[model samples]
Target: MKELQHLNKYFRKYRFKLLVGIIITMVARIFQLVMPSYVKKSIEVVEGYIGNNILKSEAKEMLLEYILIIVGAALLSGFFTFLMRQTIINVSRYIEYDLKNEVFDHYQLLSLNFYKKNRTGDLMNRISEDVNQVRLYGGPAIMYGIQTLTLFVCLVPLMFIKAPVLALYALLPLPILSVLIYQISKIIHKRSTIVQEFLSTLSTFTQESFSGISVIKAYALEPKVNAELNNLALDGKSKSMDLAKVNAWFFPLMILLIGISNIFVIYIGGKQYIDGEIASIGIIAEFILYVNMLTWPVAVVGWVTSIVQRAEASQKRINQFLQEEPNIVSTVKEETPIKGKIEFKNVTFTYEDTNITALNNISFTVNKGQTVAILGKTGSGKSTILDLIARLYDIDSGEILIDDVPIKELNLQSLRQSIGAVPQDAFLFSDTIKNNIKFGKENSTDEEIIAVAKKAVVHENIMGFNKQYETVLGERGITLSGGQKQRVSIARALLKDPQIYLFDDCLSAVDTETEEEILNQLKKESKNKTTLIVSHRVSSAKNADKIIVLENGKLIQEGTHEELNSVEGYYKELYMHQLSEKEK
Candidate 1:
């Protein structure tokens, strides 16, 4: 319930509709209460005529009038009940929509480290399944709760006013029912939380299995995967059964208590009637009607309690993520223009998850229109430099500056927008080739897309496809080959035409001939842009204005291509080895 207080703002947001629903509920119950009284009147009128208290014609007219009033009141009550559901249930749906958007927006604001700490499937389950559970509380539980309260308010006092002793006996089992519900509800809350957590785990395992199905088949691990999934399903079934067992107690308990109340109404009221302590037997019938009227609401109490407990458990999960503050917050509100002069001054960074130092006291400066190539062996921190430049992770020590302004002081969006980065592992969405390219620049013309595809040397391959750029890709662009995916990724960055271009081993998949063609085009296209190309091939770095070599997270060499080649060091050795391979 404390976690559920988060929804109070939404309740206030649609307070007008909820108020209307409440009014409709009260009116419906009031009209429904009119039925028992009219029923009593009809029964009394029949008794009067039998005892020679009234004529047949007058009695018939009175009975017909009472029947019509009862029918009319029933129809009105049904109509108002319909309106009550419309107003209240609709508000619940509105709140669900708002809550999902709120969670998604918060997810976007969080840093990459947050994603590293959480699984995708668990995040998805929180936004979807957990939210659905909360919706049950927001809609049906609230509606039935109000309905029960309205019936109690209108019916209970009427019963006591007519016959105090009978009312006392009829309500005797309710306190016991409440005590049972309290104990059951606590158990339900604990079990429901466990069930929801197990569901998240199951969802995570299933999602990962599906996403990596190709790997499973390649390794012939289908049997192993299926056995694991079966184990998870069996565990989930056990947890769900535990919850169902507790819930199964609700209705039978309610019915038993209600049955006892009905018996009390009959026996107690009958004794009073024979003693002439009551005016008529119709009063007993009226009391019986009132007790029966409470049946659904009383039955719903347990159901509502179960729903609230489940909802509270789900809300607590949702609140855990919603309260997370983003680590990388934009310091500047106003947008700053970028001219792509990047400087790294004694930057040190370590991966938090692995605690591996990716960069150590790395310092470099790139002028506004300089082309710098970074050459390094695997795990030598070439890619980390580009990530730091993009401000993906803040440095552990030292400062980064963009166009002479502290990187943190500049607008984060502006800084990132100015850079066009093609990572070592290119990722594409399950979308058309044209749309994937257009992701870099929405509303791009067909001519512009074709031009960039040619620049990236992927235009011919795309034209060979059946649908050209219109072909829809498989998940993560698996429909294309590795080289094609990389080229298409290059075309996307080329289309962006940002002030700074960071190419991180993007041409590793292409042949030397195609790589040369793409490099020539890139040299022409990026003439005035500040470019940083991180590659293993010396052919790619030979034409750069400056080259930097890294070894074991430390800068070992920095010079022009000719100077580095003249020196007998790592860059020259790599150049000689690559030159020999080309000669072969």
Candidate 2:
């Protein structure tokens, strides 16, 4: 109930439609009430003829007129019911569309850290399955629940009017049913939450296994992965059965309670009529019809209670996602174009839940047209530096500037658009080569794409395929070799033609000759653009205008190859080891 209260804002957005729907529901129910009243009149009309209140022919004519009124009320009730559904149900669908788009937009705003902490399949389930459950409650459950309430209120009083003793007798078991519904709803909500969480875990497990199926096959671990997946499926089934067990007990018990009410109306009302306390059989007959009307609403109360509980559980999960604040908030009021120059002034950063910093007191400057190479040992903070340049992660302390403007002060869209980065992973969507290169620059022409692909040295390989640039790649470009994927990633960046380009070990998969060829082409095209390369191999760093070497998160060396080689430090030590390995 509390979870639904939070959704009042969404309801308020379409309140007028909801109000009209409710009014129509009331009118339809009033017409329904007329049918039961006509049944009483039909019985009384025959009794009146026997008692001589009217002539026999007159009584027959009055009965025929009541019959027409009953039929007319029934038709009007159907029409109003249709109108109610058209207004209320359609609005629920519109709200569902808006809510989904809002959640997806929030996802786009979230930074890398959030993705690192959550699974893809878990998020997907929250958006798809959870939202759908909420829709069920918002639409049909709401309409039916209210209709039940209104019918209960209207029918019970009319029942009392026909036979006061029978109405009070029939209502004796209601308080008991209400108490049971409250208790059962609490348990149902708790169990439903557990079921939904298990569903999320199952979704995550399936997604991860499917994505890593190739690795499992290579390692010959299919049996183990399959066993784990089966266990999750079994667990999900067990919980569902548990919930089904609760429902099995709850729904039947509700029917039994309603049956008790009907039994009382028959036994007690029969005694009253025989004792001459009622005017005629019509009062008792009308009371029975009214009690039957109460039955449908009572049953619906139980059904909607279950729906409400499930919706509450789903709402709790979705609300948690909506509450998370996006790490990157763009607050820049003034926007300017980047000049490609970059400066890091005593920058420091540390990953979450860690004490050790990734970059400590790091300071460096790259002129607008310079090529800078970053060299470091494994876990020496090289890729972290490149990530900071594009604001993938924010720095803990100190300043990062682009063209004399603080990177933090620039709008995120313009900031990221100014830099073209190719990370070490080289992720490619499942699409054609032409579409992948044209991702960032959607309006890029065929001629522009060909030029960049040649600069990245991937044009020849693409031409070798049967479809050339139009050739479709599998997931993550699985059909392409490692070197091919890297070059394609580089080609994607080259097509952007951003002012600054950051490459993080992008050529590690290629041979030395191919790496040199790609690098040469990159240098030629990016002669006046800021280019930063993070590489492990000495060959990749030898020609950089400036080489910055890191060790233990500190800048221990900075200069060209000749200047660094003249000293006895980490750079020279790595250079000597490479030279001896080549000699061997």
Candidate 3:
């Protein structure tokens, strides 16, 4: 219930609708109460005729009038009930929509470390499954709760006014029912939390299995995966059954109490009439109708309690993520124009998850329009340099500057928008090739897409497809060859035409011939743009304005290709080794 306080703003947002729904619920109950009283009058009119106290014509006329009034009241009540659902239930849907968007927007603001610490499936479940449970609380639970309260307020007083002693006996079992519900609700709250958590675990396992189906098939581990899924499903079923068992107690208990109330009404009212305490048998019928009118609302008490308990459990999970503060926050509000002069002064960063230092007190400067190539072995922090420049993670110690301004002082959005980065692993969405390339520049023309595709040396391969750029790719661009995906990613970055281009070994999958062609085209296009190419190939770095070598998270060498080629260092040795491989 405390966690559910998060929805208060949404309640305030749609307060008018909820107010109308409450009024409608009350009006409907008021109209519905007219039925039992009218039923009593109809029975009394028949009684008058039987005793010769009224003429037959008078009795028939009064009976027809009462029936018409009862029918009219029922119709009006039904109509208002419809209106009540429209207002309250619809507000719940609106809140669900807003809450999902809120969660997704927060997920985007969170840093990469948050994602590294969480699973994709668990995140998906919170926004989808957990939110749905909360919706039940917002919609049906609220609607039924209002209806119950309205009936209890109106019907209870009418019952006492008509026959006080009979009313007392009829409502005798209600307090006992409430006490039992309170105890059951506690168990339900605890079990509901467990069930929702297990649902997240199950969802995570299923999503991972689907995403990595290729890996499972390649490793011939389908049987193992299937067995694991069975185990998860079985456990999920067990938890769900445990909750169902508790819920099963609700209806029978409600029925048992309701039956006791009915028996008390009949037995006590009949005894009172025999003793001359009450006037007419019509009074007993009216009391019975009043008690029966309360049946659904009273029965729904346990159901509404269960719904609220489940909602609280789900909201608690949602609040956990909603309360998370993003590690990286933009300090500047105004957009800052970028000229792409990047500087790293004594930067040292350690991966928070792994606690491995990727960069150790390394410093370098790249002026606007300078093309610097980074050469390094595996885990030499090449990719980390690109990430730092993009401000993906704040440095542990030291400062980074863009255009002579401290990176934190610049608008994060403006800085990233000014840079075009193509990472090592090319990730293409499950969309058409044209759309995937257009992701970098949404409003790009067809000619512009073709021009960049040609520049990346992927134009011919795209033309080979039946639909060319319009061809829809499989997940992560599995429809294309590895080299083709990389080139398409390069085309995307080229289309952006940003001030800084960070190509993090994007050409690793392509052959040397295609790489050379692409590099030559890049030189022409990136004439006055700052470019950083992180690659392992010497051929790729030989033509750069400057090349820096890194080993074991430390800067080892920095020089022009001509200077490094003339010296006995890592760069020259790598060039010779690659040249021998080419000759072979």
Candidate 4:
């Protein structure tokens, strides 16, 4: 009931259709149950005719009337079945849309850490495959379950009317049948949970293999990957067989109970016929018809139970994801735009799963329009600082300010809008060069893309492509060189014309000459913008107005290049190491 309630929230919007379907199903079930009586009447008519109990003319008329009723009932049942099918299918599709939208909207509000700790393929599976399961089961379970109940409700009284003794004989199996279903449902619930988990793991494996195919190919691990995939498939197969075994037991048990009831009905009804206690022909035919009606509802018990249990398992996973809160929330108070002045005062942060701090008591200030360089070792908090500025996560203590206003006081969207970042690995979508450049600014014209591309020193390279601006790049811009993709990303950032620019080793992929040209262009273009660059290369950060060096999440040094070079520290060591490597 609790699981079904969760599903109802998604499906309630289509209640009208569901109600109409229920009505049609009930009408159909009436037509279906009424047919058995018509069959009985037709048999009686035949019996009377063969015995010469009625005139031949009267017998012919009675036979035709019964035949028409049987045919009409059958036709009505077919029509109602069609109506119920259409209603359920349409409602299912709409509910699928709603569930998918809700999942996506919830995902949008989730914390970045959630994505970092989760697998993309698993998330995709929940939103796509898992939601689909809920939809497939949600609509049909309600429709068919209602139909089964309605058919049983309408048939029970008719069974008594047809023959009270036979009805009592059939009712004996109902309790045991209920017990069998309850036990099977519990077993299915447990096993199906395991099945869903295995499927999520399988999705993760498939996703990782496809996304990292290059690495697999480079390392020649295809055979190992295949072996692991085979293991997953085997595990899935075993779980499925386990579920199958449960279903196998259920069907035979159900058949056994129904079969016993039918045998009793035959013995009792046959005795009534012999003793002339009841009308022989019509009563016997009605008993057979009622027994046939019982077959479907009883047989479908295992099937509907499986669908409901699987959907329940999927709902649990989806609900868990939806309940996750974003690590950073909007401050609620909307403030005007800050003046681009930035400061991090005694800020501290630690990732949830990590013992060591990623940033510790970090304090710094960059006045508006200042160009600052961040130099650090691989494990240092250079990128972490950039992420903090973007408010991807909340600070443990202290505050980050923009233009004397606490960042939390400003609207998150507005705060992020004022900033543009180009990470170390400049990611581009599977789009044309012009579209990639205009990503940050959707309204950017071709001329604007061209201008930004030139400023980023990528215009000539883009023109060299066969289709120039219109050439569709491969996924992540794989068709382009690393340097080209980086420059395109830089152009995208520049086109935004943001108040602050964060370049996190954006120039790492280009050659020295091209790097110098891009740096020169950025220096010219960023005259009035606050720029923060995280670079390992000495040439990239050599001319910054101020340089900040970090080691192990702590600031180790802060000065100009000349001042830093005179000091014996990490930056000087990094600079000398790069110089020595160049010399070698």
Note the Cα lDDT for every prediction shown.
0.93, 0.87, 0.93, 0.85
> Which candidate, 2 or 4, has the higher lDDT?
2
Per-residue alpha-carbon lDDT of model 3 for 103-181, expressed as tens digits? Answer: 9999999999999998888899999999999998998999999999999988898789889999999999899989999
User: TM-score, each model?
Assistant: 0.97, 0.92, 0.98, 0.94
RMSD of 2: 2.7
For residues 186-302, what per-residue lDDT tens digits would candidate 2 score against the true structure? 888989999988889988998888888899999999999989988888889999988887777666876787788878877887888789887777876777777777777877777
lDDT of 4 at 235: 90
Model 2 ranges with Cα > 4 A deviation: 46-68, 463-472, 572-584
- Model 2 clash pairs are none
Of the two candidates 2 and 4, the one with more favorable TM-score, higher being better, is: 4
Ordered by TM-score, highest first, the candidates read 3, 1, 4, 2
Show model 3 residue runs off by greater than 4 Å.
none
Candidate 1 residue spans exceeding 4 A from truth:
none
Residue-level lDDT of model 1, residues 442-544, one tens digit each, is: 9789999999999999999999999999999998899999999999999999999999999999999999999999999999989999999999999999999
| Per-residue alpha-carbon lDDT of candidate 4 for residues 1-584, written as tens digits (9 for 90 to 100) | 46657767656778888889889888988888778877777788788888989788998898898888888989999999899989977888888888899889989888888998888888998998788778868677777787889878888887887678878997788888888889989999889878888888999999899878989999999999999999999999999899889978877887788888878778888888888978765777687668767787877766788788888888888888988988787875665675679999998888776655888888999989889999888878899899888888888887899888887887888888888889888788888888888888999888888999998898898888899999999877888999998999999999999999999989888998899999999998788899999998989999898899988888889989999999898888889998898889
- Which wins on lDDT, candidate 2 or candidate 3? 3
